[model samples]
Target: MTEIYYVEDDGDIGEAVKEYFESRTFKVTLYRTAEAAKESLRKQLPDLVLLDWNLPDEEGSLLCQWIRSRWKELPLMFLTVRNDTKDIVKGFQNGADDYVEKPFELEVLYSRICALLRRAGNPSGQKVISCGTLTINKEKMMVFCDGQEVSVSRLEYQLLLILMEHKGITVTRQSLLELIWDQNGNFVNDNTLTVAMRRLRQKLNQPSCIKTIRSFGYRMEDEI
Candidate 1:
């Protein structure tokens, strides 16, 4: 299923869009603010984002810039009431794949979304994620380090994938738990994360790649 992150402050519009997408079998997560949406994006990259120009907390253009800096190829579309020519140009300038004005037909919006997804190709997780000598193949759920395949448990692979997906960014412990454990109904303690990190690093034989952020969490450095 294609995952979509929709950010819109208007409750009615957000709900309508969410329902419409969900009805079509697309997994949709709706956020009312750019901050919440950004937090989610940090943990996992959705297939596409349907952003609003006027978010409650920050301008959608700012969010666009932030997302482009981190996930350059992730598709983004502005679903807003701002239909001015400058606004449309600004949306593209900030890395938007498409722009749809408010009061749009659901059918038209769906078509645009399909076109954007087609242009963006497949979701990131379906492709190999690599940094330096480490490579992760999500299709086969395998990791290779320094040209040798490394054995990793399911949880370890999940942890590594998340870190690699958000390389160079500090991934908080809370976010890691929520993304890797809570979803699977696994009751993992903080120590489990530590253990997993230790084992993953040892297996990969690159201890310096994953750095402990003291009280914060962990960050996967781009260069190992």
Candidate 2:
């Protein structure tokens, strides 16, 4: 599961955001002040951080700078009421991956958070997904298992990447069919998915990372 640190002084707003994100399966830690957030961050780093422009203890901009100074690659987003152009620019300058004004919709925030996480996972202009010993390099169009190249067909590779990208999450059969059908530009039937999965498992040497959920779909587990 992905973890998020949200720093906001407003209790109502903080709980609302935390509640909404938690319902989506994301573990969120809500901090009432910048000082409290800093204390918690020192112990455990989250996948992403959501900061408000104004805080009771310290300026959120300064805290953002503090976080970037340490975890330069960590994704940071600003969810605040500061909608001024200058404030927006300052947030970006302070190393925020995204900035969304207050009075926002949850759906938009969720999409932006997903986008930032995707970028954070695959950096340096290369698209890659890693689950345990298996690696899928989308940029170079290659797949490697246990440091050795694995030969996979186009449909097989596409199917593997989709599952790997959503690491630790179950990808339903219907969703897989739709994705592969559209991306591969070929009609994919239900049996095709089952056969491809079996072949993929064998080629990967029956890796335990990919789990078969009976009567549902498959989930890629990153923990080997």
Task: Give the winner by TM-score.
Answer: 1
TM-score, every prediction: 0.62, 0.55
Off by over 4 Å in 1: 128-224
lDDT of 1 by residue, 24-124 (tens): 99888999999888766655567889999998789999899787765566789999999999989999999998999998998899999999898877545
User: What TM-score would you give candidate 1 relative to the actual structure?
Assistant: 0.62
lDDT of 2 by residue, 1-224 (tens): 78888999999988988899999999889998988887665444577899998998898999998877755556899999999999999999998989999999998999999999998883312354566667665767887776568999898999898998787789999999999999978899999999999999899999888998888899987542
CA lDDT of every candidate: 0.83, 0.83
> Global lDDT for candidate 2?
0.83
Name the regions of candidate 2 deviating beyond 4 angstroms.
Answer: 122-224
**Steric overlap count per candidate:** 0, 0
What would you estimate as the lDDT of candidate 1? 0.83
**Clash count, candidate 2:** 0
